[model samples]
Target: MGNKNTIIWIIVVVIIIILGVVVVGNRKAQAPANVQNQTQEESTAEEESLPNNEVLPIGNNQSEGSANTDTQVSSTAIVTYTDEGFSPSTLEIKLGDSVMFVNESSGGMWVASGPHPTHTLLPSFDQKKTVQTGGTYTYTFTQAGEWPFHNHVKSSEFGKVIVK
Candidate 1:
């Protein structure tokens, strides 16, 4: 009888431990919900702030506005994303000018200014913000340099925006 009681007690302890682990795991998963909500809110606000959103064509690799060699900055530029990759693979924008990276791809695209995996070239310009088909992500250039960027999912496809 004593041995049987000891075995039953051990089984009960194991079950309690398992239940504790499952509860903790669930809490960990829910923790990110709050953070995700905040990020979505911020992104929505940024999109709302921009004006005159021009819808560029899919696979259109043309600069939305004419490249200005002089100091005059183009008001806004749209770079479309398709299976071929970012349109206008190379773009030139003036300081304080905004570039809208619009995704018209079938799946999500991760756009980040980079030197490959680490997007440290222009840290402020990097975003893991996944743009679903028809979604847009915009960034204003504050620094003057050639900022190379790539689709984090498809690294082979790359592009750069030259800020002058």
Candidate 2:
């Protein structure tokens, strides 16, 4: 009878050990997923904190024909979009200058380089995303030419930028 009791205790101890190992293994497997979720949450928080019209510059800083040859300067040009259409339907800017497209209309605006449907003209100039009302997307003119762009949401609304 004593041996039977001892055997029972040993089985119980073995079961407890197995459960501990299983719990630890499961936690280990889920650790990476938890970390990934935390990173995504942090990224979303950062993007949300930024203002809708935040000016984010993208491209090289060097500009041609500056007063200070050693120093580089870039300028920003604003083109506001309204219900009627782009306020400045035509704009002229120099290379390395950035143009900020602000959406002032009631709906979202998708700024993309035109000949509609396919934004193959100056593909890099496309915003590739929808700019909500009051939001803005800035693109630096790198190449010199007459680049036409339009609101993908309302293709009828169009504009042009002549870069020198």
Candidate 3:
């Protein structure tokens, strides 16, 4: 009788551990989907609020208007992303001009100013969130320099923006 009771307790403990693992695995899988959904919803809200040609400042350092004191957007440029990485690998734009990073790849892209990981070089250039495929992110160059950028997810791929 004692042996049978001990075996039952052990089985119950094993079952509990298995349940915990399964529950954790399920949550882990759902987390990314939940975040993605939330991001999409927020993006929709932002788009609805702003006009087609308008863009709000991106990061903490960026202000309400263009980087320059003029408070006007000079122009807009495009940088496309595919499996091969950013095309027009090196772009040259004037100050107060914006570069729109368009993701045309199979997966998401997190475009950020490099030295990678830290993204300290041009902090305002960081996208903060992943730009899903077919999505776009634009950053106006407030400062002029050779700004190197990369996909935070795929650090191996990179490009540079020459702001004049």
Per lDDT, the best of the predicted structures is 3
TM-score leader: 2
Please provide, for model 3 over 30-146, each residue's C-alpha lDDT reduced to its tens digit, 9 standing for 90 to 100: 997899898888888777766443544353235533344344657889999999999988999888889999999998899999998999999989998997899999999989899
Candidate 1 Cα errors over 4 Å, as ranges: 1-74
- RMSD after Cα superposition, model 2: 21.2
- For 1-164, candidate 2 gives per-residue lDDT tens digits of 99999999999988899988898888987887798888888777776755332433211222333443432466889999999899799999888888999999998889999878799999998888888899999999989999999999899999999998
**Clashing residue pairs in candidate 2 (N, C-alpha, C atoms within 3 angstroms):** none
Task: Report each candidate's C-alpha RMSD, comma-separated, in the order given.
Answer: 28.1, 21.2, 28.6
| Prediction 3 global C-alpha lDDT | 0.87
Q: List residue ranges in candidate 3 displaced over 4 A.
A: 1-73
How does model 2 score by TM-score? 0.58
- Candidate 1: what lDDT? 0.81
lDDT of 1 by residue, 66-110 (tens): 333233464788999898999999999888888898888897888
Model 2, residue 31: C-alpha shift (Å): 94
